[model samples]
Target: MVYDTVVIGLGPAGSTVLYHLAGRGFRVVGIDMARFPRYKSCGGCISVKVGELLDFDISHLIEHTVYGATFTYRCARMMDIISDEVVGYNIMRDRFDHHLLEQARKRGAEVVEGLRVVDVVEKKGYVEVECDEGRTFKGSFLVGADGASGITGRKVFGMDRRRSAVSVTAEVPYRSEDLGMEIDGRLFIDFGSVPYGYGWIFPKERYLSVGIAGDTLKVGGRIKDFFNTLVRGHTLLKGLRIGERVGWTVPTFYGEMPLPVKGRIALVGDTGHLVDPFLGEGIYYAIKTASMASSVIGDAIESGTPDLSTYGEMLKGEIYPEFTSAERLSDLVYNHPRLWYRMIEKEPEIMYRFYDVIRGKESFGVFYRWIWSKVRSKPWKVLRRWLESRFLPA
Candidate 1:
């Protein structure tokens, strides 16, 4: 049977697209290579703003809610950034993704698991998805929600390739009663270990998720060593028993690459390169892009003509501008991190504003401009040098 929409990948983006499609009374089919409750390398931090996007409750998947963060630089100086309310929830991806897929299934979407999509072709106004299991499915439109390394957008639709960051994560099970700083509901971020990236410690229900990330090409052989040093350097996590170690590539949004919507095919989430450039976060962006894709595709299907040409326009109007601000801010913070550290040290309000952005109380676009405006009048010699260092090419 021909489906109204064919979704590739059953992660957050693909599954949400299927959910929305079925909710709109359309026939949708989702395909994925992995079964439900599969492992995905992620920090699994659920931002507070998630409630604004998804109407359902996910508290069952939450292990803990963190309201504060400790920022450590070179494992020496430290700063405590606190929020009035809960900042975000730490979760496990396997259960979280499985729940989302189950939601789609309950909404009348057919899920084809354990089947890899080998090829996708668009002909005669329909997209044909051929699976490695010697079968094919046809649909009105196809969405490539498969991840950064997935074959859909990169191979089938021919989207332009861009540089991606490499990250390594380990989940460690440790006794909560160990003598150390508070770990119940706090987030730890260390910036001294990796260049152009940071190390993070998020507390799950029964484990601590620790990881480090940096520019792939620049960090190359040093990533593993850096990750090892991050864990060893932290006194709280130094002696913990590691339960799992995994690595993955984050498709960071730099600028405009090839457009995601092409004729009868569209790409969502990592396949569309929607991950944030500054924070290396993709789950929220994945759901947002999936919502956009589903709305556009659902309308296209109902109109008896699937016009997906406006998908890029919607992204340009909504999501792409924020990415532009994030990229500039990333260049500033990553290139001259010591300068930023010093500035934040002097003015703690800067970090509060960042926390506000994470809480969805402020916009990154405005925050970046506010930072530039404050730095426009530089008095100190060190400040001038920092600006020159950032502006001048190395």
Candidate 2:
């Protein structure tokens, strides 16, 4: 059967595309290898900006409403850098993903699960997707949301697999009274704890999502050590036994890479490397990119064309510039994490202002420039700290 749009992967990106396209009266269908409520490896923190983009309410799934974060430097010298306003919302990825797919289904989108897409090819005017078990799907346009290690990114778009972040995460179940409201509405962020990345402890109703992430090639075989240190050294995580863990790669944005659109296909979310470079933020970008991809798809469908040439242009103007700026910030923050942490500790206001960036009130470029201006004003001190960071033991 032919569909107006075939969405590959039923996670946030794919389900969002299915929801938008089907709501527009298009015949849309989403396919995924896993069944509903399947586990996903993510920090599971959705920024406040996400609410503005979605038409429906996700409050029912929210386990916590984060007002700020509790920052630490190598699991020591903890400081609370909070905001009077909301920063993000935390939800388990399984429940969050299941809820989104159900919403898409409610919008008249069909879903097919437990079949992995092995290959995709453009034929005549429609794109053909060949799945395991001899199943097949045809659609006028295809949206690939299959994630970082999926065939859509590697086989189809030829995204560079070498340039991404690796992470190890575990959700340790705990009672609400165990945290004593210390982690309530606040994230636990530890800097200078990993190579080119950081550690995070996101609070949910039932568990504490603990994880450590770093550049895949940079961290290499040492990712396990970093994860172990984070889970053990964290004061809040003390006495909690970590059990099963999952590791995955996050495809961050790279400037010189090719656009994620080819012929009748467009890639979204992790498959497109739309994740933030500095903060590893993805959920907001996933849904936003889906909204953009769906709009462009609608336009192409209305014009009786399946080509997605304009989707690349749309990303260039809207999302690419912000990612470029975030990449620049990432260079400073990740490369010299110790110094960056010290700067934040000395001037907590710097982090308070960054919360604005997280809140979407300030652009990344603006915040980056502000940091540079502060550094330039006191070059000698900043230079001394930089040199010490280079020489000091991590």
Candidate 3:
């Protein structure tokens, strides 16, 4: 059967796009390989901005309200920040993704679960997707939200895959009055405990999600070692019972794809490599970019303009700058891991300011000014330390 739009991967991005397009009275088909409510390895924190975009009552689904975050550096210096307002929500991906998929179905999108798209071919005016069950579907527009390793990105976009940081996360059920009533219910990020990355403890209603992510290419040992250390040695979490360990690789950067769109094809979410570098957050960008892609595609389909030029340009204009900036930052952070640790050591207040930038609560100029002030305050000391460390070697 011919569909107006076929969206592969019913995760956040796909679901958001399908929900918007179907609600507009378009014939949409949403496909996913996995069943609903499948567990995914993620931090599971959602910013308040995401709640507003989803238009769903996040309070109902959130396991906890994250007031802000705490940063602890290798030098044993720590700094905490309280949000001016509620910044985000913490949720389990299994429940969150399922809720989004159900929303798409309720909006009149045809959701097909447990069906994997085995092959895709572009024809004169449409794209053909063949599922593993020998069923075939055609659509004037195809969106790939299938994820980093999914076929849509690998086969169609010609994006060469490269691995960066890997994280092993475990959600353990715990109950302690001290732990349960955490001050400000903030996410605690521990640096220096792990090299090239940080460890996090995100609180939930009845459980705590603990994990560590580090640059796999630079770190000499296995990531499991870091996970083990966090669970076993961390003072704050020594008593928690072990539950389930989930691990996943995080892509730190995205080189230019050969084409984000071809005849009747467009890639969104992880398929387009939209994950953030510093925090390894993707859901916010995924949903936002997916909505943008849907608006452009929906307009093109209604106007009978199938070239998809406008959609490509729109993505370039809206999303590329942010990704470019993130790529530069990731390069610096990963290359000179000590620079981050030093900043925390010399000026711990900068860490809170950095968190503000990450949470979108403050402008980049604030971070830049803080960096400039620090450099000016002790130019020679900072320079000498960097040079001595580089030449002396560990």
Candidate 4:
């Protein structure tokens, strides 16, 4: 039987697609390899801007409402930047993802769990997805949210399999009383602690989600060393014990980002490499892009033609430009972390303005140009410090 849409991977992107389409009174089926409430290796912090997009109440799942960050350099020379307004929400990925999946199910989407999709093919009028147990599902359109390394994205879409960032993560259990409320509402972000990525400590009710990510090709080999340095040097984690560490592939946007839609199949989230290059943030983009993909999909179903050109247009216009600007900033900051750190330390307003970007009030492209304008005026000052930081020993 053919449904209106077949969604592979019930993560945020997949669930968002399923939720929207099913709410439109279309028959949508979502399939995932894992059962609900499964563990996901991530920092799991949702920016405050996300709440604006979500129509439901996620207050129940929020473990912490973040206000600002404590920035450190190699776990030293700490600088605290606290904001008056809330910045983000922290939650565990398992419960958060399960909540999203259930939202889709309640909206009339059929869910298939613990079944791996072995193959996907687009035929004359529909797409066919074959599972491991010889069961086949057909749909008018296929939404590949299976993730960066998911079979649907790699095999079916023939997408580039190279991950942009390599990361190691662990949930270190701890009681809030031991650390006190000082840790509440503030995130710990450390720079110059790793090669190309930064170390992060996002507090939860009973654990600290700790991790670091860097450009995979550039620093992938030394990620373990970087992670070890972070865990060993961070003051807050001094005497705590760390559990089994897990490695995850973060497929950030890099070289030529092609349009994710083709014929009756369209890719969303990690499958399309829709992550931020600088921050390695995917949760926001996953849900944001999922909306764009689902809108055109809904229109195609109504028109009785799976014409997805509009989806491609939407991505190129709305999403791709932001990633491009972020890639430029990533190169500058990662290449000269010490200079960048010093600059931010001296001028806290720079970081404050960036908070506006995160809050959706300013665009990254605009912010990139704004920061460059500041640096261009004092070329000699920047040159002297940048050279000193580069050639001199830390």
lDDT of 1 by residue, 329-374 (tens): 8888877777777788788889878877877888889999998877
Scanning candidate 4 in windows of ten residues, the lowest lDDT window is: 176-185
Residues 258-322 of candidate 4: C-alpha lDDT, one tens digit per residue: 66788999999998888988888899999998888999999999999769999888888888889
Ordered from best to worst lDDT, the candidate numbers read 2, 4, 1, 3
CA lDDT scores, all candidates in order: 0.84, 0.90, 0.76, 0.87
For model 3, what is the error of residue 241's alpha carbon versus the real structure, in angstroms, after optimal superposition? 2.5
Q: Which stretches of candidate 4 lie over 4 Å from their true place?
A: 391-393
RMSD of 2: 1.4
> Candidate 1, overall lDDT?
0.84
Best by lDDT: 2
Question: What is residue 49's positional error in candidate 1, in angstroms?
Answer: 0.8
lDDT of 1 at 294: 90
Model 3 spans > 4 angstroms off: 74-78, 178-183, 255-259, 345-348, 361-373, 385-394
Score every model by TM-score.
Answer: 0.95, 0.97, 0.89, 0.97
Clashes of each: 0, 0, 0, 0
Q: Over 4 Å off in model 1, which ranges?
A: 159-162, 379-394
